[model samples]
Target chain A: MSTAPNRTGAVADGGPGRAPARAARPAPTPARRALRRARTWLPGLLLVSPSILLIGVFVYGMIGWNTNLALSDKHAPIQEGEFVGLANFIALWQEARWPAAVGNAVVFTVVFVGGALFLGWLLGLLLDKGIRGEPVFRTLFLAPMAVSFIATGVVWRWLMNPAPAERATGLNALFVRFNLDFLVNDWWTAPDFGMAAMALPAIWQLAGYIMALFLAGFRGVPEELREAARVDGCSEWGVYRHVVMPQLRPVLLSAVIILGHMSLKVFDLIIAIAGQQIIADVPAVYMWAMVFEVRDPAKGATIASYLLFAVALFVIPYLVWTVRKERSEGR
Target chain B: MSVQSASGRVTAPGGRAAGTTRRGQTVKFVVLLALAVLFLLPMYVLLVTGFKPFAEATAARAWSLPQTWSGEGWAAAWEALSSGLRNSLMVAVPSAVVSAVLGSMNGFVMARWRFPGADTVFTLFLFGMFIPYQAVMIPLQQMLVGAGLMGGLFPLILAHTVYGIPICTLIFRNYYASIPQTLIEAARVDGAGMLRTYASVVLPVSAPAFAVTLIWQFTSAWNDFLFAVFLTGPNSWPVTVQLNNVAGSMVVPYNQQMAAAVLASLPTLVVYLLLGRYFMRGLMAGALKG
Candidate 1:
């Protein structure tokens, strides 16, 4: 129900007699109309002022400040500063470790995103078919999303650590049985398997999130379509492949973009699991090291800027796609 | 709605066929049960291992329960984590409440009133969400240091509040849009000013959305580790950071680590379980619609 207009615009204006009394009113003056518009908007602007102020100062402002820092050499002390004119960027681009870190980041992103999407879709498909105790199972699967990465990282680290033979968990034991201890060697010695090991914890934690998104998408599909496919004697797999998968495209796209963006910025999981000492090259980890561990603000800012550039490469496309999709959907 | 399939079979709405659906439902249940077990494995490992002694946890049978039950690890974790928990709550509660309140107001204005620069402001906020936190970490830290808030809870709170506004505003604004515009119009006609309309009319009607935002912002703030680690000193560290410290200590004890992890995560877990239904519904409503 709507609110009632009152006299002086301060109290209820719509009771049985009030509405009829106001109905036979004269139109407002142009100046009064303008005043009314201003009155309506004034409070809105005031209400939102704090949020706009904070975001403008910290988010946009800091980003601008970071870009400036990237162009300078101020690693020695916070106060001491000198403009490097792309020297840091040049050094970052030519550095052997940076390329390796970039490669590792790319690999981690691809595997985590691809693996989570595949496994999540499979599980979602299974669960969508009128599963028993559906709510219970759904909650169980989605539990990981609720837990902080800090906890997950520690748990996974224990699960992955090779030195502590007494506390060796799943991955460690498997490696021992297979005599694959070399897999845990330093990245400088054997990078491929080390990167894969680093990527596993992220995939484990994130797959469930993808499943939840897919489950929501699966629910949105009309049951009539599935029933019709079944009545036609098409196999269950065939129906999912041809009918259900196509309908889930938007959901998958959104999920991928979100996961991709998260993977690019992933820091806590890697740092918690490997520690900054071991794998010092992944952009986030490297950036964290520079800022916190090394106390090199200029270099840290440079790394951060590059990371932002990388993230923008992915985000711009996703935003464009989402906007286009929203427009098509008449949103 | 009536594009028939190539097989030429007519289907009922929502695909609810009586007998055929029941038979297929049974098969589906079986498959789902197996998947559920797979999903529950890690949780089972975590819960069981938390109760075990260090020795037992270190044993080859890591997935199984302890030979004898003990709550000592949990007690130790509690004792060790109490300080961190206090710090976490101190930062998280304020950050969440402040962000949610301010964000809701921002959202209410943006959604209901078409003001000049509102869209620009909203877009600018949205841009913040896409930028990685790592990208701004250095400058933000330096800024905090320069402001003399370094190594304190203030920086962490400020950073989280800044990061939280974008998503919180997006969620609330979208939800507010679905609210019938007539309510606000009526409030205006009744001589309600902006603040009065928001407090007496808008907010009271948006309880469900507020609850969802509260939980989300709280959990995010509580779960934050990067800022807690980088910005705050030891005294101001959150539970997540404390849990990492427990994990990183020289003589790392698995049971204690597990216990601390469990303890650190319990609040958010409880929040999730209590509001899981509303949380999921709110998320789906926003995600699917927007």
Candidate 2:
């Protein structure tokens, strides 16, 4: 099964023809050795080549092409405009809404990622207590993950009605019914915290994902480890805080990276809930409006490039680290 | 693997088997119940509002049961979303199968077959997963337009399939990596070439992997909104796009909109509920093993 060549530079073949007689003979010529090597790797390369080609063209090639488009003064998708250097980026910086969009994105990332992590961890901890109907609760928590954000946004927009006092609806109306009138406010219409309000739905959709990750992490903690901790005079809380939580750091990191990147690219939900509103605008929604609605390819591409750059700031390092860890784990 | 010890000495008051006290368990359950109810509130609203007649579907009465339940909303939703659902199926099914097949091949090679710079290639593949689709959307749209493949389900299928490569590959690669090398070696020893070995030894036990990738790809492609908006036209609008349109229209009744939302979410939701265990496996595999 090993690919390493044994001593004497003889390639070990897996065929039935791999006999002692061949090993005893004089070494084959370099050309023959190369052919033997080709026979092993050729099929493997062929198997993976299609994916490599597709990813090369669609992912890497497109990124390069997008950067070029961003640099150019292209006003529309159809036109290949002249190279304008940083004019597009300059325009985006000068636009009043650009900084607002960035601010909204920051607010969104904080609320969405932080809220989902906290809620998901709490739910995961609750589920790990060996409760009955664990699957039922897990399913309920995860049901939103199954539903499309578009659908969730539709329901949430109704729930977050921005109507006046007498015309209240959705959650506001429900609050009125429960005499919790103080809790009712404009959800996604408030100028300052609109993006944070939008994060409510995002958190609802993703908290279950974090829960699932942490639950898996919990399962990986051996029963013996907990028992040993208990035997060492550790209470249940101590066992969880000292032993279990430490083991879940990787899961936490994964959840944060996953949720962070997702929040950075938040688009569909916002568009579904509020169509291109400045109050809730993130770069992603702004990019969509720029490209499709305004037909300004250069500016749109500039915004997109920044977004890609922002995501790559974290994702590329994480990917590289994970790969290195996997390799170092002897895979 | 068990280490048998002196039972009385090891028998602590609170052990893994003995479980927590009844009161603590009840508190946890009660907390979980409250959370579940909170989590399910939106769904309850969706269902209750959908069943309500148009007049009663307004926000003020959103929490109440339908005063006079009617099927008009469901009927209208079906009428609007049915075509989009078909279009989505057209996009999702092939996207899932094609990506899964390609990923299986790539995974088998990467996991079992050693090649120069394989890890680099694998890492490159992984990088594709995290990329903002916006970065590539412009080029992809122009490329499709230039190639006369724009404005239909084809571009969506292609986009999803191409984008799906990294994740599906990661899933299958991790899955196949855990398969003992001895099995592959045994197949090779029996005169099976690489393809033959994969066909005979690898593909049989690949059902779980296939289930994971196919379900993953299907759900994503089905739920996609950005690509559907940018890549396709009204003629090829998927359920998500159609749902957005329905929900966006001010003229559409709230009941109908709720029904449409439910209709749009049903397929992936149904798949998720029926195959939840496998779905969770896919989630864990993508997250932890990435």
Best by TM-score: 2
Q: Tell me the tens digit of each residue's lDDT in model 1 across B107-157.
A: 787777646766567767777877888777777777777878887688888
For model 1, residues A214-254, the per-residue Cα lDDT tens digits are 87787787877876887888676777788788998888877
Backbone clashes, each candidate: 6, 0
Q: Which residue pairs come into collision in candidate 2?
A: none
Best by lDDT: 2
**Native contacts recovered, each model:** 0.56, 0.74
| Local accuracy of candidate 2 as per-residue lDDT tens digits, A167-236 | 8988888888888989889999988677789999989999999998988788779888988998898988
Can you write out model 2's per-residue Cα lDDT over B1-290, one digit (the tens) per residue? 12322222223223443336656666888999999988988999888889988888776676889989999899999999999999999999999999999999998888887566788999999889989999999888888989998877899999999999988998989898888987876665555667877888899999999999999999999999999999999999999999999999989999999999999999999999999987887887667464
Worst 10 residues of 1 chain B by lDDT: B1-10
